[model samples]
Target: MRIQNAFRLALVGTLGVGAGLLILSAVASLSTILTYVGVALFLALGLEPAISGLERRGLPRWAAILLVVLGVAALVAALLLTVIPIIVEQVGELIALIPVIIAQLNRVDWIEWLQEQFPLLKIDEISEQAAAALTDFFTNPDKLSELLGGVWQVALAIGSGVFAVIVVAVLTVYFTASLDAMKRATYQLVPASRRARFADLTEQITQSVGRYVIGQVSLAAVNGVLSFAFLSIIQAPFPAVLAFVAFLFSLVPLVGTLTGSIIIVLACLIPGVGSPLTALVAAIYYLVYMQIEAYVLAPRIMSRAVRVPGALVVVAALAGGALLGILGALVAIPTAAAILLIIKQVVIPRQNER
Candidate 1:
């Protein structure tokens, strides 16, 4: 019987792989569809509490949903309004300073000192070629003109991204409004005698995910704000932009914080802000903040939530990021959490039953 089961499993796996490959080759695609659905489901689950709270205050379900979504939209618009102009101005300033940075770097004592030891090393050769090419192009340009053409393509990309955002928002609103109906339909798939048990477990899982996601978001926001404040105090260029990037990247699990810090530090070098001393200070800040998040904030906010182990978190983050870049990394934590939940719910329960 066990051998028969193994053969059946192998056959199912082989067929599933073949179908997946065929879909990858032939279908328009299910990737974006699935991702959008997942995002809508997550947004609905997150907003469920707010919906309940407003309902308790005697608001109609539709009215409560609309009010919450509108509030969220307004807050998001306000944040973009405040943050966008600062980032644009900072970015322009940084780009304008690039030539000055290169010039200053060429005159640095270290470069001259290094050249003395390595006389054959033509330090300025590559820069001179780039400068000559740029001057030639600008004085009488072609490729430079082509570069300007690319700006229009960027605008189109932005438009597409905005469209995607709108679609996601619409889906989220629909999902949130029909959450109870969706749950009912989902539970309908289970046997009648098991529906209550399934519902209870589903509620537990949703609550767990909600708590974990909310806590992680709060921690990321705090980290961003603190980082921006620290960078501003140290007179780092593009502090707000870097902090915003950090916040966005923070949705990815363990490695994101470190990746963001590295990017910020590299960008800091562009505008003459990141000195050795400042770099050391930044390192210390990261260490302190990471310690606090891991030991203090995370424990307080997410302890009763995920219960995913430290080692597993590290492994999942690394493996996921390696395979799927940022999306993989972001999905890894929840995937690991769900697996842990399933092990407890199924394996341990059955073991104890026996």
Candidate 2:
């Protein structure tokens, strides 16, 4: 009888393991879809504060959601129409200017000195290879055919991306509209005695996330505007393109501003159009701006939304970027805040009670 019971237990354990593996495989297969849904949920949460604000000012929930969605769509359309052409033109100009830049580099004293100092380091050969690679990639018929051969694959990828974006946008609209009802439903899962506590904790977490999103957007905007103004002042080519890139990069936490600044400086140093002096000035301006952002802007803007420690912010951003790229990094801070809140409110109190 004992042997029979042991055999039955082993059979059940094996079946459980098999089922778990099957579930895991299914989840892995649908990982991309899951990622899109998660991104949509995050965006919906981020948009909640704005929706709530509009509602407070007498707009119906649906009306406010529509207005916000329309405004965002218009802004995206405007950016695409205006910025894309300028970036394409600048990229073409840069490619054409590359040979000229190489010729000028050969004439520079630093290049001669460096080559002399490191005899094994063939700067000219390296540059030639790089130039040839770029030229071939662009003008070679073989490369062009190869690129064209993959056009179908590219199109399919693009279609998938578009479908994902549409799914996310639709989901975000729905989530924003029904967020309150969803919260109520979520609270219903808790026992009657614990519902109030759960509600309070959930509200704090959601509020923190909303505030972080709004504050991050505001900071990115400020960085982009400042970068645009500084680049224009320095007579940098493709200021508009650089500004748009800056805005996107500045959305990441911790190292985002520095990364955007480096890109701007590099843009200012483009072969024929950019000068070292312009690059230096742009770098200096960014350094000063970063200081101001750190000392003044961040404290004021981010203080109300979420209070993450500086060290933890860096770790979270790095880990998130490593795990899931930019989206991960963007959500990391709020996630860290939520975790911290949980530890503070639940973990600590439970430990004390014990």
Candidate 3:
């Protein structure tokens, strides 16, 4: 290598590595801040449409804001009242069976099959293994609360997380009511010559995110209702609880729906509602629903506004789950869709023009 060229190459490599590490450290520290920002943005988007409707109803601006906020508060209050009792009843039923369920696991046919497949596996003592698994599963305070504990604990955890949500709601009201002012402020930040392009990108992102929120809410409602219907048909206990789980998890992208299905399947197995055939029947049911959702349901419900290919949906969901657990996975698809919109706006137009 020529000495000067080698020196330049090494300088560029060092700079790149330095930049990467800086970004990583900044992200680690700033993640909490970014989370609040994303929450505020999503809330603003969802509330903006409702706020607009109120404005068009000849409501004064402050009155419109108050109406929208109060309306949301009423919904939240209703959920707490209506859903908690059902969840608690079902949860008591579930935990009451835990010791019995643990015993039942040792008696499953699959355990013997596993022993035969690896005879020496019992060198670890099969009973001890089962006991240890149960012990560990119930030992973690957070995990156990989510699973084996009373419904009240779960509800308390949910209530604890409500602070961020309340803040987001307050921010959303201010942002939505002043959207036009926000827009003008945003434009002022850009050089006048570049404002048009910036405005277009901003508008595109707003529409995409808004569409995503509305679509997911509608889809979740449908999933919740369908799940309740199926659970009720099978005479499964806790139909309402299962349906509520479906509704909440539905906010998650692809994986959330899958999880809700598996949960219902497990709950049914608890009651022996469809015991031997439960998993198979549940799988087949979702397979049919998945087809309907992919082809007919999403297009009509989501307005083809965010075109997430099936393969990409799975990839994004898995990646999001690996990185940040379930909530990340839920938000990942729409985030991907927004990024794709930006890329298409720049790349596709340029390609066609070329």
Candidate 4:
């Protein structure tokens, strides 16, 4: 009897372990779909504030959602129609100028100055090697084929990206339209005693997320517009393309603006594209812009959106970036806010009772 009981326990334990592993494997397999759902949900939450504002003005929910969605779609269409072609043209120009730029590297005044200052660093030798390698790569048939293969890979990636965008768009509309119902359903999962509190907390968290998203996008738009105007005024190369790059990078929090500014400055220093003076001017402009953004813009825009401590923000951003790259970093602050709220409201109260 004792042997039979032990055998039964071991069999059950083995089965449970196997089931847990199977569940994990299934989750891993569905990771991409899960990511799509998460992104769609995040966007839906971001749009909620707009919907709420329209509702406050006595607009019906359906009409409000429709208006906001159409507005966003129209804005996106306009950008694609006007800006995308210019950016593409600039990119092509940059690529065509690559060989010329490489050949003229030694003619750049700063390069000569750097070589003079650092005699031990064989800058000329390095430039020659790079130019020779590039020339060989362009002439070699095998290298041309490899380049074509890379282009094919890029085409495939673009297609996949388009598909993902469509999926997420559809999902965002569905989620936005049904968010109230979804919240009610989620509230139902809580016990009757806690349902009200849970709903309240959830509302606060969603609002915080919505505000953060709007503020962050506003900041990015500001940077992109200013960058384009400044670069164009200075006749920096590929203003449209660099501005688009700035816009994209500024979507990431914390280090994004700085990183984008550095890239733009480096682009300005490219031989034949811009001179040393141009690079210097661009750097100075970005330095001033960064200070304005950090001191004046960010604090005002983000004050109400998130209230996490400075130290926690740094830690959360780093941890989130490490774990899930850009998406994680984008959501980290609001997630931290939600956690802090729960701790203050629920955990502390429970501990006090204990």
Candidate 5:
């Protein structure tokens, strides 16, 4: 009887492990779908504040949502219509100038200086070899075919991206429309005694997320506008395209602005587009701008949005980026804030009681 009981226990343990593995496998398989759903939900929460604001001003909920959505759609359409073609043209120009840029690099003062410093290093030889390799790659049929295959892959990826955008957009609208209902349903799952508290915390969390999204976007817009103005003034290459790039990168947390600034400065150094003095001036502007952004703009804008500590923000952004790339980074700060709120309201109190 003892042996039979032990055997039964082992069988159950094995089954439990198997079930757990199967569940994990299922989750892994559904990861992409899950990511889309998560992004949609995040965006819905972000739009909630605007919808609520409109609702407060005597608009019906449906009308408020419709207006906000239409406004956003219009803005997106306008940007695409005006900016995309210019960006594409600028990109083509950049690609066409690559050989000229490479040839110019061989004559750069820095290359000569580096060669002077390192007597054994043959900078010209390396540059020539690189140029030759590039020329050979372009001329070779097999290499050209490989390049064509890569282009096909890029085309497929773009198609997939468009499908993803559509999916996320539709999901966002659905989630936004039913968000209140969803919340109520969620509250119902909690015990009556705890439901009110849960609902309150949920509201707070969602509001924080919404405000953060708005604040972040506002910052990005500021950066984009300033970047465009500055780049134009400096006669930098593709001002509009570079500004758009800045705006997109600024949407990410922590390292976004710095990365954008670096890219812009590098672009300023590109042969035919900008000179070394132009790049230096652009770099200086960005350095000062970053300081202003850090000390002034971010604090003022983000103060009401989320009250995360600087250290925690860095850690959360890094961890989130590692886990889910940009989306993870975007959500990480709010997730941390939500966790902190729960810990303060629930965990600490429980500990005190104990």
Candidate 6:
């Protein structure tokens, strides 16, 4: 009897260890899958407002979900068809014009001043070396192979991104279609006594998230349009490309607009395409725009959805970006807002009552 009991205990221990290892392995491999699911869930939540509105207007829930999905797909397809070719062509043009830009830079007064002062600045040598290096990289087989390798990596990345997008799209559709069911199922998980409060909190959070996503997208659009206009006014060669960059970067939290604006301004100062005066003008425009966005636009757009302190916004953005790169940065503000809402509604109230 004693031996049998010991044997049973050992068997249980071994099984537990095996199960633990299996679970860890699964988690490690499914990290990316989890990320995709999370992104889709978040996106569904963001689109909930439109879905709810349509349902309120007497449309069937399924029809509203389908409509919202189709509308989003059409918008994305249209944007890709219209903007991709222009960006590609502009990128090629920019690359081809680099030597000319460098040559133009050689004639700048600052170059001459640096040469005169430092004596060892050797601007001509540096320029020549840079030109020669570029020429060699194009003409040399080994260097050309490196370029091809980079292109291959880019292709692989694009393929992976497409796969992720498809997965997210499918999941988003499923989640949006079953959102109410999901909510009810979630509520069922809570204790009967707490379920009502949980439902209310969930609803509030989802509504806030929906508003935030919509507001952020709108703000990004505004930034992109403004950037395009500013670049065109300065005769910047790649206005479309710069604007697109602005649109993408502006999707991130606090630092995104500033980062995009700086990049565009620097592009405007490229020697062959733009003048110092144009760069200065671009800089000034962004400075004023940032202030206006902070004081006026953001408040008008985002205040209703989520209001977080400016310092907290910065901290959250930095931390999120550090942890998960762009996606982290993009979601950080809303996540912070959600956390804040919970603390305010649940924790603080509980503490005060106690």
**Best model number under lDDT:** 5
| Best-matching candidate per TM-score | 5
**Candidate 6, residue 39: how far the Cα is off, in Å:** 2.0
On residues 1-354, what C-alpha lDDT tens digit does candidate 4 reach at each position? Answer: 699999999999999999999999999999888888988998999899999999999999999999999988999999889899998899899899999988897466865887999989998888889899999999999999999999999999999999999999999999999999999999999999989999999999999999999999999999999999999999999999889889989989888999999999999988888888998999999999999998899899989998889889989988888987887888888899899999998999999998
Residue 131 displacement in candidate 4 (angstroms):
10
Candidate 2 residues lying further than 4 Å off, grouped into runs, are: 78-117, 121-163
Whole-model lDDT values for every prediction: 0.80, 0.88, 0.77, 0.92, 0.94, 0.89
**TM-scores for all candidates?**
0.80, 0.84, 0.73, 0.87, 0.89, 0.83
lDDT by residue (1-354, candidate 5, tens digit) is: 699999999999999999999999999999999999999999999899999999999999999999999998999899899889988998998899888888887677876887899989998998789899999999999999999999999999999999999999999999999999999999999999999999999999999999999999999999999999999998899898899989999999999999999999988888877899999999999999999999999999999999999999999999999999989999999999999999998899999999
- What are the clash counts of all predictions, listed in order? 0, 0, 1, 0, 0, 0
Model 1, C-alpha of 28: deviation from truth (Å) = 7.9
Question: Residue 67: error of model 6 in Å?
Answer: 1.9
Tens digit per residue, CA lDDT, model 6, 14-126: 99999999999998899898889878988888899999999999999889988999999899999999889999999999999989988886677865777888896788788
TM-score-based ranking, best first?
5, 4, 2, 6, 1, 3
Candidate 3 lDDT (Cα, 0 to 1):
0.77
RMSD to the true structure for each prediction, in A, is 5.2, 3.9, 6.0, 3.4, 2.9, 4.2
Cα error, residue 277 of model 5, in Å, equals: 0.8
Mark the 10 consecutive residues where model 5 has the least summed lDDT.
Answer: 105-114
Model 5's C-alpha root-mean-square deviation from the true structure amounts to 2.9
What's the distance in Å from true for residue 94, model 5?
3.6
What is the Cα-based lDDT of residue 216 in candidate 6?
A: 88
Per-residue C-alpha lDDT of model 2 across residues 121-232, encoded as one tens digit per residue: 9978887898899998989899988889799789999999899889998888778778899999999999999999999999999988988988999999998888778788
Error of 2 at 223 (Å): 0.5
